[model samples]
Target: MSEKARMTTHKLFLLPDYEKEGEYLTKMHSVGWKLERVSGFSQHFVKCESENVVYKLDYAANNTNYPEYIKMFADYGWEHCGRVMGFDYFRRNADGLSEEEMEIFSDPQSKLDMMKRVILTRMTPLLIIFFMGILPNMYMIVVNSMNWDRSTLLFLAVLYLGVFALYVSIFIYCIRGFRKLKKKYTE
Candidate 1:
């Protein structure tokens, strides 16, 4: 498949804070649309053409009117996939909330999970270099010491140091990038 066709943009719509579920149903029905309630949070998947749009209904603070909207969509025969309490990390909302709020609403556990994955990825290469390159070089150095080759020892030392520096540089870059991303999202 073409890249463009494979790439689909999923837009999130946040229902108004005080709007009743029925009101949203009325609006959607008017546009020849309907919402299908999934499970938790009164979420619905809106269908248009061949695409199913996912909606997450949150009334956390001042918007606790979801049943009405659910009824409205039910009346119109719109099918919904399922409901979920929260969205995955990749979902994007097209509401007025700022970037900071978006970051805050994002699941902290998911962020930490991603961080762990990144750290593991960064460590894998360093561990491989240490075991395969550095350890073997160290063994060679020990073996060579018995031969009393001063120049060979110096070269091995320099090579080991070079490998160590390269490993340190890579680790530093990964750590700094991870920190920057964490600061940007958390702050």
Candidate 2:
């Protein structure tokens, strides 16, 4: 990465939608943009000389031999790009691989298992916190707001609208992502 790197904020919750994230990164790489790092909600990219770079995301935080695991992928042409919350990002130049050969996992079942692990290990905590804590609090707020005027309710609602939207989006994404994987792998 160069010193004069540029970045943009993306709302792509890579958590259940890793394939979509990978596709987005691949598109960026193909346009001569290489992912440098992900910080906060921004995906930082550096200008690169080459296009047609492939990107992939995998759940690797659960792996005990993470170094060797990354080494294995490195041996297979994928360079370790970065990590965001245990999801490992990888990239490689599309020099010689065919269209079907660009994927990191060999089969859908393995990929499905990986996605499951992500849901259980990562999404579960988020679900617990949101449904158990945040949603109930939001409900109570709404109930309490019934005694107040519309303006007061609206004023207080602003405090958690973003958080509520985030949790809702995450829940939807997790369900859809899991279904997508299950349909492809189980059938």
lDDT against the true structure, each candidate: 0.46, 0.80
lDDT of 2 by residue, 1-187 (tens): 5476576757556576778788888888777778888765568888776588888888965688888999999898889988888888888878788876688888777887787788889888888888788888788887898698888788768878878887787688778878876787778
TM-score of 2: 0.78
Model 1 lDDT tens row, 1-187 = 5332121223332222112333344344344344444333444445433322223233222225656644544453322333343322112222454545333236765555555544554356567867897778777787778786788778878888887787777667656666765675476
Clashes of each: 7, 0
Which residues of candidate 2, in runs, are more than 4 Å off?
Answer: 1-5, 135-166
| Per-residue lDDT value at 129 in model 2 | 86
* Model 2, residue pairs in steric clash: none
lDDT of 1 at 55: 32
- Which 10-residue window of candidate 2 scores lowest in summed lDDT? 5-14
TM-scores of all models? Answer: 0.37, 0.78
Error of 1 at 34 (Å): 38
